[model samples]
Target: MMSSPSPTTAQASSTAVAKRIARTARLALEKKFAVVTAQIDRELESAEDVVIDCFYNADSRTSQLNKDDEYVHLLKLRSRQPFSLVKSIVLKDGEYEGHVALIMKQAFPFAFMKLNMEIRKHVYEYLFESEEKVIRIKTKTGGQKLPYAPGYNTYNRAAILAVSSEVRLEALPVMYDRKFCFESTSILMHFLLQICDGRIYLTDLNVESYVGSTARTSFYLLANCKRLRRIFFKHISSNEQPKTAIKNFWNDAQPWLTAASAGQGDPTAALKLLVFDRTAFHFRVKDPNSKSTSVKAWQLADHLVFVKGLKDKLMDARKV
Candidate 1:
């Protein structure tokens, strides 16, 4: 019973409805795209942080990119830089990926290997050598329990050794030429173990010696230092039987002495100086079981005799 609508009006209404549906679809697609873009941005930021941390915080100079596949992909996409470039890259505040690319592009392009051997040696020495008279080696994680001299300067140039393998190989010898002073025999042993073959280049060393397996092991390792020129041993007294302490001293010392005496050249040819503390031959040990109120020191006569014997042995070894 109702009148039919005009064709033009119906066509117009249909067109309006179609336009509305299209607008809604467009808005929904836009919202979806916005969400995806934001997620991608967050991922990129996270990946950058990971890359920066790896570049700076890694314990060794090795690639740690396998930790995260996504970040690894991100890094690969960002840049195909060499490990040395990656290592030498340092970022400042507010800098990001674009800046890193710019830096990589602008950094010195001359190959280090292209330099003359003498020039390369000079560069290595400049970087690895410390102005400090003595470099004090400390444990990676420990309290500073040992007393250090106040006036003397100490340095830590070990970071250069971690730059790259090529750099390490060339710089190690220069680094080891320094006068290293350790707080204790344990620390000296640890240092020697850490350096591995680098010990062969060590020329000078100073250490406080305690009567223990650690000291013995340290001396045993010292035999590997075929180029050693001088060693200063500071005797540290501990609670043990006098005879046991003296025997431990001899046991710890015998290996290095025998090696030096048996050198390819003159006896004691490898060592320019062999120093010992003034009280090196003397020992004061307390018997835990003894109720004696006073501790007995080694007899001065026996101490002098031991000192003379050590001196005579050293003199005999030093004769050309």
Candidate 2:
């Protein structure tokens, strides 16, 4: 720690700003889960009025830009990188999908680059700090000392990158298979365990509840073994998912949100800080559901949050 506050603190906000970057991830993941669960229950009840076939065309639909808004702006043509620009696998549930998009870099097209090393993907997020070792300098206004520091401070930066090109699951060999969710969930658990060691918040764009499901569940998966941090989400989807899906998402995710949306002057930071002070904060995003993640994350800041849902056929691989 330093004795005096840094001078440049006034020039910048001096706080660790969560870098927002542009990205497109698996859409309505929680909703997908909810829908499938509902669909399954309905199936059990023999409810057959819903037409469940138009969602995923088993045969490759023409791959092109669908000109959709952010949340539903999934499925696009990649200008670069041969492997999946789309993060994870989109499983076709009987009704909708139990798809998975990777926030961690799934894998690089190493064969093209020929690095001869396995591509390790991770959602490495650091907010405003350019570097890891950020020291805060609290500012004082009234009668006396600040909280042992000044309101101004400075730090370097963290890894920030937006999805430069379009990412599409259709681009990758991923198919919408319904039988693989539980197994897939297990694999996701394994991957989360391997990379995530502590209570680190994994941010995401909430296409649904914005802050909760996208951010909380991602963090919870990582927090399974450890305590979790602030997992903030910015909403990026339209309101088309089943109402039950939305409710279940909120029901499961609100605790994290209520806790995460705690103190601090900046609503965003306060929302994010809610995670830091408590066990974990499940943040739904603030953006509209129609905004694309790439638009939201990239256009907003220098870095964006991505959770890597490992692309491996998780059933085959053992957790490290």
Candidate 3:
């Protein structure tokens, strides 16, 4: 007869089974996360009207009561991969009484689409397992009580999607390869312009922050955004010569800018104004859809005259 298995053998078998069970459970949670996120994306695409009404319309039913809340802000997904970014928002009561919840309309099943903290942890583990610093949990402090799940009192968290955490502008992790993907610039711009208070006074000039070593990158990125109204670029350090680099960058990108402007019917139309200084750069656009009065042909000529002439003037002054 076969000898009965030893206790050590039985223990080993049990350990292996436990590991498999844990692995399977983890995978199941990840799959659920994938399905929910995919469904959210599909709903977003089909429900453009709902998105606008719920998020943008301040006079909408949801905003009617919260109008007095001064700290109203939109939450946005910040990701190096363009498609992975989810467009979502979080609104809080200025007095800090209620839960910080995701902004959603009644039409969408916010409860079903929302993710539990456990699932968010799993998703981040799957996608950014190597980069743990990117995702963070907000600690309760200053009399702010965050929402929590059952059986928890101190640290409460609900199925709310929170993507509006503040991130250092230029010091993104190395995983985000900006030059390889131009949309990265768009994502960063949206973070600075749309998600934030709609403007950034850039004091950091790291190449990664600008997405490239030239001003052309900023121009191309801004060309795609319609909501950004104004931005100020100032030199934080003397080592970084922004004015000279920007002039060269603009000249290289002018052909593409001209073509884009012509398509829009006004050369200065895509952007309202671009003011250059040896120490700073200022930009303004009245409205995304608004067009400039100057004709396309004349706008290009005028820009060349202004930009090139300004560059020459600065250079000549330095010689004296």
Candidate 4:
């Protein structure tokens, strides 16, 4: 038989074992916390890089930001955090201050309306209108569509219009004044749909036409544009049943001409010009009565001449 251990010895052994277990748990917790902190720091750094890139290379940076996992995670984390906690962490005096300031400016824009009217107009023109820049509506690789200024190498200035309703009301006319060039009638219609009522201010448009329901519908929508002044149609096909095509063209244009005549009280509101590709003049249509007879498409121009109110509003694209 062995002697029983003392109570004091047994108590001391139990305390020692408890301390080892406690120490291991503490170390594991500390390691996990350190890893989490490091990951947060990395995400912050990545977010900072994205913000900076947005100002310098907007188009590419925007695309990258949309796909970045770490940035997305940071956004979700920030959304979950309490406002006080977020402010204390993000607004601490350090490398993040500048980025925070930029974000704040965007979030809370200055009172642009307080500026003088002329200054506001100038700023709007500078951002939205340029003689050298023709805003081109384009589709991206992911099938997302938006307008861009290829000549200026920048995205469309429409972002400013979303600042506030006041800004949009003041800036819309200036924005719609820019000449928009689209690849096809369908793209033009899509843009018109996106802009909604902004079409009322549109003055200049350039587009390639396709003979189909989409083109007819696009023209029908355009007829409602009360201030449209000029439209340049490119690559119209002359061989597509000239008589029927000419009839459809006149029908599509009739609404616009009627509107222009009705708005004669406002001289500036009338359609000033309609330009078409020279190819449209070569249309050959078979006479319905004579099976073998083909007629020249000059009838299209002739029909325009006979319209009651249109005086020298039509021209070949080359003349423009």
lDDT of 3 by residue, 157-252 (tens): 211224333222221221121111112233343333432322222221122223344445445444443333333232212222335544554554
For model 2, how does the per-residue alpha-carbon lDDT over 1-320 read when each residue is reduced to its tens digit?
76765677743544334221111223456667656544322111112542221232223443334547323322222223333333566666755478563322223333422332232111122233223232222323567422321221343222122222222211111111100111122233333444332223233211212333334454355423212233322332332222333444444444443334333232232233221111112323445786643212222111112111111211112222
lDDT agreement with native, every candidate: 0.64, 0.30, 0.38, 0.62
For model 1, the superposed segments whose C-alpha errors exceed 4 Å read: 1-77, 80-108, 140-166, 236-246, 267-272, 281-304, 307-320
What is the number of backbone collisions in each predicted candidate, taken in the order shown? Answer: 0, 46, 5, 0
Using TM-score as the yardstick, the better of models 2 and 4 is 4
TM-score of each predicted structure versus truth: 0.52, 0.18, 0.23, 0.53
Residues 117-232, model 1: lDDT tens digits: 89988987776655577777767555653333333334544666776798788888887887988878888888888778898999999887664768888888888787788898
Clashing pairs in 4: none
Which runs in model 3 stand beyond 4 Å of their true positions?
A: 1-215, 236-246, 251-265, 270-278, 281-320
Give stretches of model 2 more than 4 Å off. Answer: 1-190, 201-219, 222-246, 262-320
What tens-digit string does per-residue lDDT give for candidate 4 at 25-105? 999999986666555432323353232221122222333344545432222223322222223224556765634432421
Clashing pairs in 3: 75-89, 147-156, 147-157, 148-156, 148-157
Error of 3 at 198 (Å): 13
Worst 10 residues of 3 by lDDT: 174-183
Candidate 2 vs candidate 4: the lDDT winner is 4
Best by lDDT: 1
Q: Give me the runs in candidate 4 sitting further than 4 Å from their true place.
A: 1-109, 140-156, 240-245, 265-271, 284-320
